[model samples]
Target chain A: MINATLRELSVALAAKRISAVELATLFLDRIQRLNPALNAFITVDRDKTLEMARAADVRLAAGDAGPLTGIPLAYKDIFCTEGWLTTCGSKMLSNFVSPYDAHVVERFKSAGMVTLGKCNMDEFAMGSSNETSFYGPVKNPWNTDRVPGGSSGGSAAAIAARLAPAATGTDTGGSIRQPAALSGLTGLKPTYGVVSRYGMIAFASSLDQAGPMAKSVEDCALLLNAMAGFDSRDSTSLERPAQDYAHDLEQPLRGLRIGLPKEFFGDGMEPGVRAAVEAALAEYRKLGASTVEISLPSSGLSVPAYYVIAPAEASSNLSRFDGVRYGYRAPEYVDLADMYRKSRAQGFGEEVKRRILIGTYVLSHGYYDAYYLQAQKIRRLIANDFVEAFKHCDIIAGPTAPGTAFEFGAKSNDPVQMYLSDIYTIPANLAGLPGMSLPCGFDAGKLPIGLQLIGNYFDEARMLNVAHRYQQVTDWHAQMPKGSA
Target chain B: MSLNLDQVERIARLAHIEISPAEAAQTRDRLNAIFDLIEQLQAVNTAGIAPMAHAVDVSQRLRADVVTETIDRREVFQAIAPEAEAGLYLVPRVIE
Candidate 1:
């Protein structure tokens, strides 16, 4: 039952096979069992979870429930959940209770979904590895010594361990897909602005996007249907009509053109990961999709360019968390300036402070044109590369990361090494294109290697279609860690 | 392109993040490493490229100036402030 996908859970829910409260309790119990070892969830309030479940139960009983009604899903702590501790895995807001709900949180609430709990994340969605999380790094369920990828590490680890059926994650430079890749779950980052970011803790606003992470592409599609829509409140949100992301799940891949970027398959990739991604591509070929070698010339610049832009945006966006109005305040300070400095320094983790400093430096008067403006120009070049690549193929394929999950401290010491893990996934976020990752195969050590599929802007349905077809003939998504069961 | 301790200290102040002297040395090394890594981008010819501010070409969206959200819950919002007096967040004195 814990291994069931969202579709199976939805069917069971709709048919009254299980009560909403019962389902929430089942997962809650499993979470209580496994979360200690995994650290997937930061906060699991039984009272709040059960209370939400009871409300969902009422909706189910009244026959006013939607497809997601009674479904229990966890949210990454970045989203502000009214009355719940909405820490973005940072001590700055660790003790802060939100007064409002994030747009994603409100969508789940309206769908009658029960909040399982808040999942852990990198502090303010900063790092590629979950090690940056102040709550403690989430362990890869496959190997206890390895990390689950970050920003959405908790959500990914939760799904991988079967602690939760599905969850929401935010991606700013591969937060969703990279963690999804490392944890061997189906992670999607829809085209920018598909989901509103109104109440999500801001992190590089331009690149930040919320998407679904689940056990299967079909499950992700179902969740995306509920999570996406136009919101007038968020200026960046596209005013597109709502469409079922699951509509094309059964579409044949006969004429699909899959682009294999020559850059992603280069020397950067581990042999095992390259082998797994190549195997997935051959499977697609058998499914009648044709593969083409495409060039994304500017992809090489993605990591450096992202470091400049994302942090610049983060530096500006996070300025809201000063010591006065909300969030952490220094316990001892002689003056206003002293209070602000001590509060931020003490509240934020290492990576967060580093990013803020870099952001401040780049956007500073003498450096704006040299660093910030130049990164934006590189952003344009990278976007142009995707535009050129997409013209030749329907979707781009690659290894989600250069290698499989590594031990917690392996790349944490060097920020550059950590940033490189996101190389393949970052381009999509840069271009605001939809991207998804799913388990293709396991490496020598048995850690999962993900095959990433990136689509043109607003191409989620077609991408889901392609992923669904691959999942149909393969069982990679079905495999779980030996002890997880 | 590497930042020295003084620049790191200045950047920290600009960012409103206080870094102690011991931490400053390490922060300088890390930031300098990153800056060195990014220095490669300077070689790309982007003279004619228009800077992309977002993934999609979208202009700043505008709405009618009518109040969309009311500050009616101002107190509720400030309830979490570390110190508040009469619904005002109390910070260290700005005036001498």
Candidate 2:
């Protein structure tokens, strides 16, 4: 039951084989037993979750159930759930409980999905690994000593460990896809503005997007169908018509063009990861999909460009969390200025402080032209590279990360090495194109290797279709860690 | 493109955060390394290419200027600070 996919769980519920309350209890129990080892969740309210489950069961009884009507899902701590602790994995928001639901949360509730709990994440969704989370890092379920990838590490870890059937994650510069890659889960980051961001606490406003992480691409598709839509509240939300992301899941891959970017397959890619991605491409070819070697030359510069642009935007968005607001504040201060200084100093983690400083420095008057402005220009070029590549293929394929999940603290001392992990994933964010990472094969140490599928702007349905077909032919995503729940 | 310790301190101050001397030194080294990598972008000629800010070329949507609703300031400020005796965020006096 714990390892069942979202679609399976929904079918079981509809058939009266299991009640939503029973399923919720099973996940809550799994979370209670396993979260201590994984630290994947920051908060799990049994009362609220059971209440939601009860409501879902009632809806199911009335035959008002949808595909996700009774499935349990975890929310990354960043998305605001009214009366729930939406900490955003920062001490600054430690005591903050949102008064209203984020658009995503409201949509999920309307679908009658059970909220298992809130997963942990990096503070302000700023870090590559989950290490920067104030709550502590999430352990990869595959190997406890390794990281689960991050700012959506908790979400990935939870789904990987079967703590939740599915979970929601937000990506800003590779948070969702990278972590999903490391943890061997199917995670999707839809095109920017496809999912409303009204109450998902802003990190890098332009780059931030919320999506689903689950056991299969089909599950991710169902979650995406519920999560993606137009919302007037979020100024950036696309006012496009509703989409059935799962509509083309079983579409035959005949005549599909998959672009393999030369830069992605070149240096910096681990031998094992390259082998796994190549093998996945071979399988796609068997399914009648053709591959073309293309070049995203500007993709090599994505990491540097993203670090500057994301942080520059982060510095501006995070300004709202001053001492005067409804978050952590210094207990004692000599004056207002002292209050601001002490509050921020005590509130933010080391990585958060480092980014704030870097963001401010780059956006500062003297350095803006040299750093921020140049990064913005490079961002355009990176996006253009995708535009050019897409003209030749329906989707681009690559390794989500350069390598599999590294041991904890392996690259913690070196920020640049850690930043480079997002090299393949960052370009998608820069282009505001939808991207996904699905388990393709295992590495030498048995860590999961992810094959990334990137779609053109608003091409989520096509991307999911490609991923679904791949999952249909391979069992890599079905392989779970050897453990007793 | 390299940032010295002094420059790091100045940047931190400009950003309105306080950093210790040790952290400033560390940040300087890290930022310099990152800047070195970013320097590669300068090699590309972006002449006449309008910098793209967003993926979609759509213009920003405009909304009517009419007020849809209003919030009570007193209630809004209620959670601004731990102690809000008045309709304001209470803080220690800064000015002399």
Stretches off by above 4 angstroms in model 1 are: none
Model 2 iRMS (Å) reads: 1.9
Each prediction's DockQ against the real complex: 0.86, 0.58
Per-residue lDDT tens digits for candidate 2, residues A376-428, read 88888888888899899999999999999988998778887888888889999
Interface DockQ of candidate 2: 0.58
- Candidate 2 TM-score, true structure as reference: 0.97
Predicted structure with the largest lDDT when compared to the true one: 1
Q: Cα miss at A426, model 2 (Å)?
A: 0.3
Taken over the whole model, the C-alpha lDDT of each candidate is 0.92, 0.88
Docking class of 1: high
Docking quality level of the chain pair in candidate 2:
medium
